[model samples]
Target: MELLFLGTGAGMPTKERNVTSIALTMYEERGSFWMFDCGEGTQHQVLKSPLRLSKLEKLFVTHLHGDHIFGLPGLLSSRSNQGGTASLTLYGPPGIKEYIRTSMQLSQSRMNYELNIIEIQEGIVFEDEQVSVSARMLDHRIDSYGYRIEEKPKLGTLLTEKLNGLGIRPGPLFGMLKRGMDVTLEDGTRIIAADVVGPPVPGRTIVILGDTRPSEGSAALAKRADVLVHEATFAQELSDLAKEYYHSTTKEAAQTAVEAEVKALILTHISGRYAQDGAQLLEEEARSLFPNAYVAHDFWSYEIPVKSREEI
Candidate 1:
Protein backbone atom coordinates (compact mmCIF):
# COMPACT_ATOMS: atom_id res chain seq x y z
CA MET A 1 0.00 0.00 0.00
CA GLU A 2 1.02 3.59 -0.66
CA LEU A 3 -0.23 7.06 0.29
CA LEU A 4 -0.27 9.92 -2.20
CA PHE A 5 -1.12 13.41 -1.07
CA LEU A 6 -3.36 15.12 -3.60
CA GLY A 7 -3.52 18.35 -1.55
CA THR A 8 -1.98 19.18 1.82
CA GLY A 9 -2.78 22.81 2.50
CA ALA A 10 -5.49 23.87 4.93
CA GLY A 11 -8.72 25.82 4.16
CA MET A 12 -7.48 27.40 0.90
CA PRO A 13 -5.00 26.81 -1.88
CA THR A 14 -1.51 28.23 -2.15
CA LYS A 15 1.17 28.14 -4.83
CA GLU A 16 3.05 25.50 -2.87
CA ARG A 17 0.02 23.42 -1.81
CA ASN A 18 -3.72 23.02 -2.29
CA VAL A 19 -6.46 22.01 0.17
CA THR A 20 -6.78 18.68 2.00
CA SER A 21 -7.09 15.44 0.02
CA ILE A 22 -5.26 12.13 0.35
CA ALA A 23 -5.17 9.02 -1.83
CA LEU A 24 -4.42 5.58 -0.50
CA THR A 25 -3.38 3.49 -3.46
CA MET A 26 -3.68 -0.27 -3.16
CA TYR A 27 -3.08 -1.10 -6.79
CA GLU A 28 -1.23 -4.32 -6.05
CA GLU A 29 -3.84 -5.70 -3.67
CA ARG A 30 -7.11 -4.40 -5.13
CA GLY A 31 -6.25 -2.98 -8.56
CA SER A 32 -7.73 0.31 -7.37
CA PHE A 33 -7.24 3.26 -5.02
CA TRP A 34 -9.26 4.92 -2.24
CA MET A 35 -9.42 8.62 -1.42
CA PHE A 36 -9.50 10.02 2.09
CA ASP A 37 -10.82 13.51 1.37
CA CYS A 38 -11.66 15.41 -1.83
CA GLY A 39 -10.72 19.04 -1.36
CA GLU A 40 -11.17 21.70 -4.03
CA GLY A 41 -8.96 21.18 -7.11
CA THR A 42 -8.30 17.61 -6.00
CA GLN A 43 -9.11 16.20 -9.43
CA HIS A 44 -6.47 18.52 -10.87
CA GLN A 45 -3.95 17.13 -8.41
CA VAL A 46 -4.81 13.54 -9.41
CA LEU A 47 -4.17 14.38 -13.06
CA LYS A 48 -0.60 15.30 -12.16
CA SER A 49 0.03 12.12 -10.14
CA PRO A 50 0.41 8.48 -11.15
CA LEU A 51 -3.11 7.71 -9.88
CA ARG A 52 -5.89 6.80 -12.32
CA LEU A 53 -9.40 8.15 -11.86
CA SER A 54 -10.79 5.00 -13.45
CA LYS A 55 -9.25 2.97 -10.62
CA LEU A 56 -10.91 4.94 -7.83
CA GLU A 57 -13.04 2.49 -5.86
CA LYS A 58 -14.03 4.33 -2.68
CA LEU A 59 -14.01 7.81 -1.17
CA PHE A 60 -14.09 8.39 2.59
CA VAL A 61 -14.89 11.95 3.61
CA THR A 62 -13.87 13.01 7.09
CA HIS A 63 -16.20 15.99 7.50
CA LEU A 64 -18.46 18.38 5.60
CA HIS A 65 -15.88 21.15 5.42
CA GLY A 66 -15.74 22.83 2.02
CA ASP A 67 -12.03 22.20 1.77
CA HIS A 68 -12.75 18.51 2.32
CA ILE A 69 -15.82 18.03 0.11
CA PHE A 70 -15.77 20.84 -2.46
CA GLY A 71 -14.14 18.63 -5.07
CA LEU A 72 -16.47 15.71 -4.51
CA PRO A 73 -19.02 16.57 -7.17
CA GLY A 74 -16.39 17.50 -9.73
CA LEU A 75 -14.35 14.36 -9.15
CA LEU A 76 -17.37 12.11 -9.29
CA SER A 77 -18.63 13.71 -12.47
CA SER A 78 -15.26 13.49 -14.11
CA ARG A 79 -14.88 9.85 -13.13
CA SER A 80 -17.86 9.01 -15.32
CA ASN A 81 -16.28 10.82 -18.24
CA GLN A 82 -12.88 9.19 -17.63
CA GLY A 83 -13.74 5.54 -18.26
CA GLY A 84 -14.61 4.85 -14.62
CA THR A 85 -17.44 2.36 -15.08
CA ALA A 86 -17.03 0.45 -11.84
CA SER A 87 -19.34 1.21 -8.93
CA LEU A 88 -17.97 3.74 -6.46
CA THR A 89 -18.86 3.96 -2.80
CA LEU A 90 -18.62 7.18 -0.76
CA TYR A 91 -18.70 7.40 3.03
CA GLY A 92 -19.20 10.70 4.81
CA PRO A 93 -21.04 12.60 7.53
CA PRO A 94 -24.84 13.02 7.75
CA GLY A 95 -25.17 15.95 5.32
CA ILE A 96 -23.03 14.40 2.57
CA LYS A 97 -25.91 12.57 0.86
CA GLU A 98 -27.91 15.80 0.49
CA TYR A 99 -24.86 17.80 -0.56
CA ILE A 100 -23.90 15.36 -3.32
CA ARG A 101 -27.49 14.79 -4.48
CA THR A 102 -28.21 18.52 -4.63
CA SER A 103 -24.96 19.26 -6.43
CA MET A 104 -25.60 16.57 -9.03
CA GLN A 105 -29.22 17.66 -9.44
CA LEU A 106 -28.36 21.34 -9.92
CA SER A 107 -25.53 20.61 -12.32
CA GLN A 108 -27.69 18.13 -14.25
CA SER A 109 -24.83 15.68 -13.99
CA ARG A 110 -25.43 12.18 -15.34
CA MET A 111 -23.22 9.30 -14.30
CA ASN A 112 -22.65 6.10 -16.28
CA TYR A 113 -21.72 4.18 -13.17
CA GLU A 114 -23.37 3.31 -9.90
CA LEU A 115 -22.83 5.75 -7.04
CA ASN A 116 -23.29 4.53 -3.45
CA ILE A 117 -23.31 7.09 -0.66
CA ILE A 118 -23.41 6.11 3.02
CA GLU A 119 -24.02 8.69 5.74
CA ILE A 120 -21.71 7.22 8.32
CA GLN A 121 -21.87 6.93 12.11
CA GLU A 122 -19.24 5.82 14.63
CA GLY A 123 -18.08 2.16 14.28
CA ILE A 124 -17.05 -0.10 11.41
CA VAL A 125 -17.96 1.85 8.30
CA PHE A 126 -16.68 -0.72 5.78
CA GLU A 127 -15.55 -4.32 5.95
CA ASP A 128 -14.74 -7.04 3.44
CA GLU A 129 -12.67 -10.19 3.32
CA GLN A 130 -9.37 -8.39 2.81
CA VAL A 131 -9.70 -5.28 5.00
CA SER A 132 -11.85 -3.39 7.50
CA VAL A 133 -12.31 0.33 8.18
CA SER A 134 -13.63 1.79 11.43
CA ALA A 135 -14.45 5.38 12.36
CA ARG A 136 -14.74 7.33 15.60
CA MET A 137 -16.07 10.79 16.36
CA LEU A 138 -13.34 13.35 16.78
CA ASP A 139 -13.18 16.73 18.53
CA HIS A 140 -13.68 19.18 15.69
CA ARG A 141 -15.98 22.13 15.07
CA ILE A 142 -18.47 19.79 13.46
CA ASP A 143 -19.05 16.07 13.89
CA SER A 144 -15.72 15.16 12.34
CA TYR A 145 -14.36 11.59 12.33
CA GLY A 146 -11.09 9.68 12.25
CA TYR A 147 -10.72 6.40 10.39
CA ARG A 148 -8.72 3.29 11.23
CA ILE A 149 -7.95 1.09 8.23
CA GLU A 150 -6.58 -2.31 9.12
CA GLU A 151 -5.53 -4.87 6.56
CA LYS A 152 -6.25 -8.49 7.42
CA PRO A 153 -3.26 -10.66 8.18
CA LYS A 154 -1.83 -12.49 5.19
CA LEU A 155 -0.78 -16.12 4.93
CA GLY A 156 2.93 -16.88 5.24
CA THR A 157 5.19 -17.84 2.38
CA LEU A 158 5.20 -21.47 1.22
CA LEU A 159 8.23 -23.46 2.29
CA THR A 160 9.26 -24.72 -1.13
CA GLU A 161 12.57 -26.16 0.11
CA LYS A 162 10.86 -28.05 2.92
CA LEU A 163 8.19 -29.39 0.61
CA ASN A 164 10.76 -30.51 -1.93
CA GLY A 165 12.75 -32.31 0.75
CA LEU A 166 9.67 -34.34 1.61
CA GLY A 167 9.38 -35.66 -1.97
CA ILE A 168 6.47 -33.33 -2.58
CA ARG A 169 7.21 -31.83 -5.99
CA PRO A 170 5.38 -28.70 -7.11
CA GLY A 171 1.75 -29.70 -7.86
CA PRO A 172 -1.71 -29.60 -6.28
CA LEU A 173 -0.06 -30.56 -2.99
CA PHE A 174 1.90 -27.31 -3.05
CA GLY A 175 -1.26 -25.31 -3.64
CA MET A 176 -3.00 -27.03 -0.77
CA LEU A 177 -0.05 -26.44 1.55
CA LYS A 178 0.03 -22.77 0.62
CA ARG A 179 -3.65 -22.58 1.58
CA GLY A 180 -2.75 -23.88 5.06
CA MET A 181 -4.21 -27.29 4.50
CA ASP A 182 -2.87 -30.68 5.67
CA VAL A 183 -2.57 -33.12 2.82
CA THR A 184 -1.74 -36.82 2.44
CA LEU A 185 0.56 -37.41 -0.50
CA GLU A 186 0.30 -40.29 -2.98
CA ASP A 187 3.04 -42.06 -0.97
CA GLY A 188 0.82 -42.04 2.17
CA THR A 189 2.97 -39.31 3.78
CA ARG A 190 0.88 -36.94 5.89
CA ILE A 191 2.16 -33.38 5.61
CA ILE A 192 1.20 -30.73 8.15
CA ALA A 193 1.07 -27.12 6.96
CA ALA A 194 2.12 -25.63 10.29
CA ASP A 195 5.29 -27.70 10.46
CA VAL A 196 6.62 -26.24 7.18
CA VAL A 197 4.93 -22.87 6.73
CA GLY A 198 6.32 -19.72 8.32
CA PRO A 199 4.38 -17.58 10.74
CA PRO A 200 1.59 -15.36 9.42
CA VAL A 201 2.76 -11.96 8.29
CA PRO A 202 1.08 -9.13 10.18
CA GLY A 203 -0.89 -6.56 8.21
CA ARG A 204 -0.40 -2.80 8.34
CA THR A 205 -2.69 -0.29 10.02
CA ILE A 206 -3.20 3.34 8.95
CA VAL A 207 -5.11 6.07 10.75
CA ILE A 208 -6.35 9.20 8.97
CA LEU A 209 -8.04 12.04 10.82
CA GLY A 210 -10.02 15.02 9.68
CA ASP A 211 -9.80 18.58 11.11
CA THR A 212 -9.80 18.16 14.88
CA ARG A 213 -8.29 19.13 18.20
CA PRO A 214 -6.35 16.63 20.34
CA SER A 215 -8.82 14.12 21.76
CA GLU A 216 -9.01 10.54 23.02
CA GLY A 217 -10.88 9.50 19.90
CA SER A 218 -7.95 10.47 17.70
CA ALA A 219 -5.47 8.66 19.93
CA ALA A 220 -7.64 5.59 20.15
CA LEU A 221 -8.08 5.38 16.40
CA ALA A 222 -4.35 5.83 15.89
CA LYS A 223 -3.19 3.38 18.50
CA ARG A 224 -0.14 1.49 17.19
CA ALA A 225 -0.92 2.43 13.60
CA ASP A 226 1.79 2.02 11.00
CA VAL A 227 1.06 5.57 9.84
CA LEU A 228 -0.99 8.38 11.41
CA VAL A 229 -2.13 11.20 9.15
CA HIS A 230 -2.92 14.20 11.40
CA GLU A 231 -3.65 17.80 10.56
CA ALA A 232 -1.22 20.46 11.75
CA THR A 233 -2.90 23.70 10.81
CA PHE A 234 -0.65 25.89 12.94
CA ALA A 235 2.77 26.07 14.52
CA GLN A 236 3.56 25.95 18.23
CA GLU A 237 3.36 29.73 18.60
CA LEU A 238 -0.20 29.81 17.26
CA SER A 239 -1.50 26.93 19.38
CA ASP A 240 -4.15 29.13 21.00
CA LEU A 241 -5.32 30.14 17.53
CA ALA A 242 -5.40 26.50 16.55
CA LYS A 243 -7.62 25.61 19.51
CA GLU A 244 -9.88 28.59 18.84
CA TYR A 245 -10.30 27.46 15.25
CA TYR A 246 -10.89 23.85 16.29
CA HIS A 247 -7.68 22.73 14.65
CA SER A 248 -4.43 21.23 15.82
CA THR A 249 -0.92 22.67 16.15
CA THR A 250 2.31 20.93 15.19
CA LYS A 251 3.07 20.15 18.81
CA GLU A 252 -0.40 18.83 19.47
CA ALA A 253 -0.28 16.59 16.39
CA ALA A 254 3.11 15.21 17.29
CA GLN A 255 2.01 14.59 20.85
CA THR A 256 -0.92 12.52 19.65
CA ALA A 257 1.40 10.37 17.53
CA VAL A 258 3.63 9.82 20.54
CA GLU A 259 0.69 8.99 22.77
CA ALA A 260 -0.77 6.60 20.21
CA GLU A 261 2.58 4.85 19.65
CA VAL A 262 2.28 5.11 15.91
CA LYS A 263 5.21 3.97 13.77
CA ALA A 264 5.12 7.16 11.67
CA LEU A 265 3.30 10.51 11.74
CA ILE A 266 2.45 12.43 8.58
CA LEU A 267 1.41 16.05 9.21
CA THR A 268 -0.93 17.65 6.69
CA HIS A 269 -3.66 20.36 6.36
CA ILE A 270 -1.04 23.12 6.67
CA SER A 271 -2.25 26.72 6.74
CA GLY A 272 -1.27 28.82 3.72
CA ARG A 273 0.37 31.26 6.07
CA TYR A 274 3.28 28.84 6.11
CA ALA A 275 5.19 29.54 2.98
CA GLN A 276 7.72 27.04 1.62
CA ASP A 277 10.21 27.69 4.44
CA GLY A 278 7.51 27.97 7.08
CA ALA A 279 6.15 24.53 6.16
CA GLN A 280 9.57 23.07 6.80
CA LEU A 281 9.46 24.61 10.27
CA LEU A 282 6.18 22.84 10.94
CA GLU A 283 7.79 19.50 10.02
CA GLU A 284 10.75 20.25 12.23
CA GLU A 285 8.51 21.07 15.18
CA ALA A 286 6.61 17.78 14.75
CA ARG A 287 9.87 15.83 14.48
CA SER A 288 11.02 17.30 17.77
CA LEU A 289 8.33 15.25 19.54
CA PHE A 290 8.01 12.32 17.13
CA PRO A 291 11.18 11.31 15.34
CA ASN A 292 9.38 9.75 12.36
CA ALA A 293 7.15 12.74 11.62
CA TYR A 294 6.92 14.03 8.05
CA VAL A 295 5.07 16.93 6.39
CA ALA A 296 3.13 15.90 3.29
CA HIS A 297 3.21 18.21 0.26
CA ASP A 298 1.03 18.10 -2.82
CA PHE A 299 1.76 14.92 -4.86
CA TRP A 300 4.07 13.56 -2.17
CA SER A 301 3.92 9.76 -1.91
CA TYR A 302 4.96 7.30 0.78
CA GLU A 303 5.07 3.52 0.71
CA ILE A 304 3.78 1.42 3.56
CA PRO A 305 5.53 -1.85 2.86
CA VAL A 306 4.03 -5.13 4.03
CA LYS A 307 5.58 -6.77 7.06
CA SER A 308 7.91 -9.65 6.37
CA ARG A 309 7.87 -12.98 8.19
CA GLU A 310 10.98 -11.99 10.18
CA GLU A 311 9.36 -8.72 11.23
CA ILE A 312 6.29 -10.60 12.42
Candidate 2:
Protein backbone atom coordinates (compact mmCIF):
# COMPACT_ATOMS: atom_id res chain seq x y z
CA MET A 1 0.00 0.00 0.00
CA GLU A 2 1.12 3.58 -0.69
CA LEU A 3 0.15 6.97 0.72
CA LEU A 4 -0.07 9.99 -1.60
CA PHE A 5 -0.22 13.42 -0.02
CA LEU A 6 -2.19 15.78 -2.22
CA GLY A 7 -2.29 18.75 0.18
CA THR A 8 -0.60 19.05 3.59
CA GLY A 9 -1.04 22.64 4.74
CA ALA A 10 -3.29 23.47 7.66
CA GLY A 11 -6.47 25.68 7.49
CA MET A 12 -5.64 27.40 4.20
CA PRO A 13 -3.75 26.95 0.97
CA THR A 14 -0.24 28.29 0.61
CA LYS A 15 2.13 28.59 -2.33
CA GLU A 16 4.06 25.57 -1.08
CA ARG A 17 1.05 23.49 0.02
CA ASN A 18 -2.69 23.37 -0.60
CA VAL A 19 -4.79 22.00 2.28
CA THR A 20 -5.41 18.62 3.93
CA SER A 21 -6.01 15.69 1.57
CA ILE A 22 -4.45 12.25 1.38
CA ALA A 23 -4.90 9.27 -0.93
CA LEU A 24 -4.29 5.75 0.30
CA THR A 25 -3.75 3.68 -2.83
CA MET A 26 -4.24 -0.09 -2.67
CA TYR A 27 -4.03 -0.86 -6.36
CA GLU A 28 -2.20 -4.15 -5.86
CA GLU A 29 -4.36 -5.32 -2.97
CA ARG A 30 -7.83 -4.08 -4.06
CA GLY A 31 -7.38 -2.27 -7.40
CA SER A 32 -8.70 0.96 -5.89
CA PHE A 33 -7.88 3.96 -3.74
CA TRP A 34 -9.39 5.81 -0.76
CA MET A 35 -9.22 9.53 -0.01
CA PHE A 36 -9.21 11.39 3.28
CA ASP A 37 -10.24 15.07 3.52
CA CYS A 38 -10.89 16.68 0.11
CA GLY A 39 -9.84 20.27 0.55
CA GLU A 40 -10.38 23.05 -2.01
CA GLY A 41 -8.76 22.39 -5.39
CA THR A 42 -8.22 18.74 -4.42
CA GLN A 43 -9.39 17.52 -7.82
CA HIS A 44 -6.77 19.73 -9.42
CA GLN A 45 -4.20 18.18 -7.14
CA VAL A 46 -5.36 14.66 -8.01
CA LEU A 47 -5.06 15.55 -11.70
CA LYS A 48 -1.37 16.17 -11.10
CA SER A 49 -0.79 12.78 -9.46
CA PRO A 50 -0.82 9.23 -10.79
CA LEU A 51 -4.12 8.55 -9.01
CA ARG A 52 -7.32 8.13 -11.03
CA LEU A 53 -10.56 9.59 -9.81
CA SER A 54 -12.38 6.71 -11.52
CA LYS A 55 -10.55 4.25 -9.28
CA LEU A 56 -11.49 6.06 -6.07
CA GLU A 57 -13.81 3.77 -4.08
CA LYS A 58 -14.20 5.66 -0.82
CA LEU A 59 -13.83 9.12 0.74
CA PHE A 60 -13.50 9.63 4.51
CA VAL A 61 -14.05 13.14 5.79
CA THR A 62 -12.62 14.07 9.17
CA HIS A 63 -14.97 16.92 9.93
CA LEU A 64 -17.18 19.57 8.34
CA HIS A 65 -14.55 22.29 8.19
CA GLY A 66 -14.52 24.22 4.91
CA ASP A 67 -10.84 23.59 4.36
CA HIS A 68 -11.34 19.86 4.89
CA ILE A 69 -14.41 19.40 2.64
CA PHE A 70 -14.96 22.36 0.27
CA GLY A 71 -13.85 20.39 -2.77
CA LEU A 72 -16.18 17.45 -2.24
CA PRO A 73 -18.93 18.60 -4.58
CA GLY A 74 -16.57 19.48 -7.42
CA LEU A 75 -14.62 16.24 -7.06
CA LEU A 76 -17.76 14.15 -6.92
CA SER A 77 -19.18 15.77 -10.02
CA SER A 78 -15.93 15.54 -11.92
CA ARG A 79 -15.64 11.87 -11.06
CA SER A 80 -18.79 11.20 -13.06
CA ASN A 81 -17.47 13.18 -16.01
CA GLN A 82 -14.31 11.09 -15.82
CA GLY A 83 -16.30 7.85 -16.15
CA GLY A 84 -16.41 6.81 -12.50
CA THR A 85 -19.52 4.66 -12.57
CA ALA A 86 -18.73 2.32 -9.74
CA SER A 87 -20.44 2.72 -6.36
CA LEU A 88 -18.70 4.96 -3.85
CA THR A 89 -19.11 5.19 -0.08
CA LEU A 90 -18.31 8.26 2.05
CA TYR A 91 -17.84 8.11 5.81
CA GLY A 92 -17.78 11.14 8.05
CA PRO A 93 -19.28 12.94 11.03
CA PRO A 94 -23.01 13.80 11.17
CA GLY A 95 -23.07 17.09 9.21
CA ILE A 96 -21.22 15.67 6.23
CA LYS A 97 -24.30 14.33 4.52
CA GLU A 98 -26.08 17.65 4.66
CA TYR A 99 -23.03 19.49 3.37
CA ILE A 100 -22.59 17.24 0.31
CA ARG A 101 -26.29 17.14 -0.44
CA THR A 102 -26.71 20.89 -0.27
CA SER A 103 -23.64 21.59 -2.34
CA MET A 104 -24.70 19.24 -5.12
CA GLN A 105 -28.21 20.57 -5.05
CA LEU A 106 -27.11 24.17 -5.26
CA SER A 107 -24.74 23.43 -8.11
CA GLN A 108 -27.35 21.30 -9.97
CA SER A 109 -24.85 18.48 -10.33
CA ARG A 110 -26.06 14.96 -10.93
CA MET A 111 -24.08 11.81 -10.20
CA ASN A 112 -24.22 8.82 -12.53
CA TYR A 113 -23.15 6.32 -9.86
CA GLU A 114 -24.56 5.40 -6.50
CA LEU A 115 -23.20 7.41 -3.60
CA ASN A 116 -23.48 6.13 -0.07
CA ILE A 117 -22.98 8.54 2.79
CA ILE A 118 -22.65 6.99 6.25
CA GLU A 119 -22.57 9.09 9.39
CA ILE A 120 -20.05 7.35 11.59
CA GLN A 121 -19.82 6.82 15.36
CA GLU A 122 -16.92 5.85 17.60
CA GLY A 123 -16.40 2.17 16.76
CA ILE A 124 -15.79 -0.26 13.95
CA VAL A 125 -17.24 1.43 10.86
CA PHE A 126 -16.27 -0.93 8.06
CA GLU A 127 -15.00 -4.50 7.79
CA ASP A 128 -14.44 -6.99 5.00
CA GLU A 129 -12.41 -10.15 4.62
CA GLN A 130 -9.29 -8.21 3.71
CA VAL A 131 -9.48 -5.20 6.05
CA SER A 132 -11.32 -3.48 8.89
CA VAL A 133 -11.60 0.23 9.68
CA SER A 134 -12.48 1.82 13.01
CA ALA A 135 -13.08 5.43 14.04
CA ARG A 136 -12.55 7.25 17.33
CA MET A 137 -13.59 10.75 18.38
CA LEU A 138 -10.74 13.25 18.71
CA ASP A 139 -10.27 16.43 20.76
CA HIS A 140 -10.74 19.12 18.16
CA ARG A 141 -12.80 22.30 17.79
CA ILE A 142 -15.54 20.21 16.23
CA ASP A 143 -16.48 16.53 16.23
CA SER A 144 -13.34 15.41 14.46
CA TYR A 145 -12.35 11.73 14.12
CA GLY A 146 -9.31 9.51 13.73
CA TYR A 147 -9.36 6.36 11.65
CA ARG A 148 -7.54 3.07 12.18
CA ILE A 149 -7.16 0.86 9.13
CA GLU A 150 -6.14 -2.71 9.95
CA GLU A 151 -5.41 -5.28 7.31
CA LYS A 152 -6.45 -8.86 8.10
CA PRO A 153 -3.82 -11.52 8.64
CA LYS A 154 -3.12 -13.67 5.62
CA LEU A 155 -2.48 -17.41 5.56
CA GLY A 156 1.14 -18.49 5.50
CA THR A 157 2.79 -19.38 2.26
CA LEU A 158 2.11 -22.93 1.08
CA LEU A 159 4.86 -25.44 1.84
CA THR A 160 5.37 -26.67 -1.70
CA GLU A 161 8.32 -28.97 -0.94
CA LYS A 162 6.60 -30.50 2.08
CA LEU A 163 3.44 -31.05 0.07
CA ASN A 164 5.42 -32.63 -2.75
CA GLY A 165 7.02 -35.05 -0.28
CA LEU A 166 3.53 -36.08 0.76
CA GLY A 167 2.61 -36.89 -2.87
CA ILE A 168 0.50 -33.74 -3.19
CA ARG A 169 1.56 -32.13 -6.43
CA PRO A 170 0.67 -28.51 -7.24
CA GLY A 171 -2.95 -28.36 -8.42
CA PRO A 172 -6.41 -27.35 -7.22
CA LEU A 173 -5.56 -29.06 -3.93
CA PHE A 174 -2.68 -26.65 -3.41
CA GLY A 175 -5.03 -23.70 -3.54
CA MET A 176 -7.32 -25.39 -1.07
CA LEU A 177 -4.46 -26.17 1.27
CA LYS A 178 -3.26 -22.59 1.18
CA ARG A 179 -6.73 -21.52 2.24
CA GLY A 180 -6.43 -23.66 5.38
CA MET A 181 -8.65 -26.44 4.05
CA ASP A 182 -8.01 -30.12 4.57
CA VAL A 183 -7.94 -32.33 1.49
CA THR A 184 -8.18 -36.08 0.85
CA LEU A 185 -5.91 -37.65 -1.74
CA GLU A 186 -6.92 -40.27 -4.33
CA ASP A 187 -5.39 -43.02 -2.13
CA GLY A 188 -7.64 -41.96 0.81
CA THR A 189 -4.80 -40.14 2.64
CA ARG A 190 -6.06 -37.10 4.51
CA ILE A 191 -3.91 -33.96 4.75
CA ILE A 192 -4.37 -31.57 7.65
CA ALA A 193 -3.82 -27.93 6.68
CA ALA A 194 -2.48 -26.79 10.05
CA ASP A 195 0.22 -29.49 10.10
CA VAL A 196 1.63 -28.31 6.78
CA VAL A 197 0.97 -24.56 6.86
CA GLY A 198 3.54 -22.16 8.37
CA PRO A 199 2.81 -19.44 10.85
CA PRO A 200 0.22 -16.81 9.92
CA VAL A 201 1.57 -13.60 8.41
CA PRO A 202 0.75 -10.58 10.52
CA GLY A 203 -1.14 -7.68 8.95
CA ARG A 204 -0.29 -3.96 8.87
CA THR A 205 -2.03 -1.27 10.88
CA ILE A 206 -2.27 2.47 9.95
CA VAL A 207 -3.76 5.32 11.90
CA ILE A 208 -4.69 8.79 10.50
CA LEU A 209 -5.91 11.53 12.75
CA GLY A 210 -7.75 14.76 12.02
CA ASP A 211 -7.01 18.25 13.43
CA THR A 212 -6.85 17.90 17.17
CA ARG A 213 -4.91 18.30 20.37
CA PRO A 214 -2.97 15.29 21.57
CA SER A 215 -5.53 13.05 23.24
CA GLU A 216 -5.79 9.50 24.58
CA GLY A 217 -8.11 8.60 21.71
CA SER A 218 -5.31 9.33 19.24
CA ALA A 219 -2.93 7.04 21.11
CA ALA A 220 -5.56 4.30 21.44
CA LEU A 221 -6.33 4.35 17.73
CA ALA A 222 -2.62 4.35 16.90
CA LYS A 223 -1.42 1.58 19.19
CA ARG A 224 1.39 -0.34 17.51
CA ALA A 225 0.53 1.15 14.14
CA ASP A 226 2.87 0.51 11.26
CA VAL A 227 2.32 4.15 10.22
CA LEU A 228 0.78 6.97 12.19
CA VAL A 229 -0.30 10.16 10.31
CA HIS A 230 -0.87 12.97 12.82
CA GLU A 231 -1.29 16.71 12.55
CA ALA A 232 1.49 19.08 13.61
CA THR A 233 0.13 22.57 13.14
CA PHE A 234 2.67 24.35 15.26
CA ALA A 235 6.32 24.29 16.26
CA GLN A 236 7.60 23.61 19.82
CA GLU A 237 7.86 27.33 20.62
CA LEU A 238 4.16 27.96 19.82
CA SER A 239 2.83 24.95 21.74
CA ASP A 240 0.67 27.22 23.89
CA LEU A 241 -0.92 28.72 20.77
CA ALA A 242 -1.44 25.25 19.35
CA LYS A 243 -3.27 24.12 22.49
CA GLU A 244 -5.32 27.32 22.48
CA TYR A 245 -6.45 26.58 18.91
CA TYR A 246 -7.10 22.93 19.68
CA HIS A 247 -4.30 21.81 17.40
CA SER A 248 -1.15 19.82 18.05
CA THR A 249 2.49 20.94 18.13
CA THR A 250 5.45 19.06 16.72
CA LYS A 251 6.39 17.78 20.15
CA GLU A 252 2.83 16.73 20.94
CA ALA A 253 2.52 14.80 17.69
CA ALA A 254 5.80 13.03 18.41
CA GLN A 255 4.63 12.22 21.92
CA THR A 256 1.49 10.61 20.55
CA ALA A 257 3.53 8.44 18.17
CA VAL A 258 5.86 7.40 20.98
CA GLU A 259 3.04 6.58 23.35
CA ALA A 260 1.33 4.47 20.68
CA GLU A 261 4.55 2.62 19.81
CA VAL A 262 4.12 3.29 16.12
CA LYS A 263 6.88 2.20 13.78
CA ALA A 264 6.83 5.50 11.85
CA LEU A 265 5.13 8.87 12.12
CA ILE A 266 4.26 11.31 9.31
CA LEU A 267 3.22 14.79 10.42
CA THR A 268 0.70 16.67 8.25
CA HIS A 269 -1.69 19.65 8.42
CA ILE A 270 1.22 22.06 8.86
CA SER A 271 0.36 25.69 9.55
CA GLY A 272 1.04 28.15 6.75
CA ARG A 273 3.14 30.22 9.12
CA TYR A 274 5.86 27.62 8.56
CA ALA A 275 7.31 27.93 5.10
CA GLN A 276 9.48 25.24 3.55
CA ASP A 277 12.39 26.08 5.87
CA GLY A 278 10.16 26.40 8.92
CA ALA A 279 8.56 23.09 8.06
CA GLN A 280 11.99 21.48 8.19
CA LEU A 281 12.40 22.83 11.67
CA LEU A 282 9.16 21.17 12.71
CA GLU A 283 10.45 17.84 11.43
CA GLU A 284 13.70 18.34 13.33
CA GLU A 285 11.83 19.03 16.56
CA ALA A 286 9.64 15.97 16.11
CA ARG A 287 12.64 13.81 15.28
CA SER A 288 14.28 14.88 18.52
CA LEU A 289 11.45 13.11 20.34
CA PHE A 290 10.78 10.28 17.84
CA PRO A 291 13.56 9.51 15.42
CA ASN A 292 11.24 8.11 12.74
CA ALA A 293 8.99 11.15 12.60
CA TYR A 294 8.73 12.95 9.22
CA VAL A 295 7.02 16.09 7.95
CA ALA A 296 4.91 15.48 4.84
CA HIS A 297 4.64 17.95 1.93
CA ASP A 298 2.24 18.14 -0.98
CA PHE A 299 2.81 15.58 -3.77
CA TRP A 300 5.08 13.51 -1.53
CA SER A 301 4.38 9.77 -1.48
CA TYR A 302 5.45 7.13 1.01
CA GLU A 303 5.19 3.38 0.68
CA ILE A 304 4.44 1.43 3.81
CA PRO A 305 6.84 -1.52 3.69
CA VAL A 306 5.47 -4.93 4.51
CA LYS A 307 6.67 -6.30 7.84
CA SER A 308 7.97 -9.85 8.03
CA ARG A 309 8.03 -12.14 11.04
CA GLU A 310 11.77 -11.67 11.56
CA GLU A 311 11.44 -7.87 11.57
CA ILE A 312 8.76 -7.97 14.27
Q: Where does candidate 1 stray beyond 4 Å?
A: none
RMSD of 2: 1.0
lDDT, residue 191, candidate 1: 92
lDDT score for residue 155 of model 2: 81
lDDT string, candidate 2, 68-128, tens digits: 9998999999999998999999999998999999999998999999999999999999999
Clashing pairs in 2: none
What is the Cα-based lDDT of residue 263 in candidate 2?
94
**TM-scores vs. true structure, each candidate:** 0.98, 0.98
Cα displacement (angstroms), candidate 2, residue 266, comes to 0.3
Candidate no. 2 TM-score: 0.98
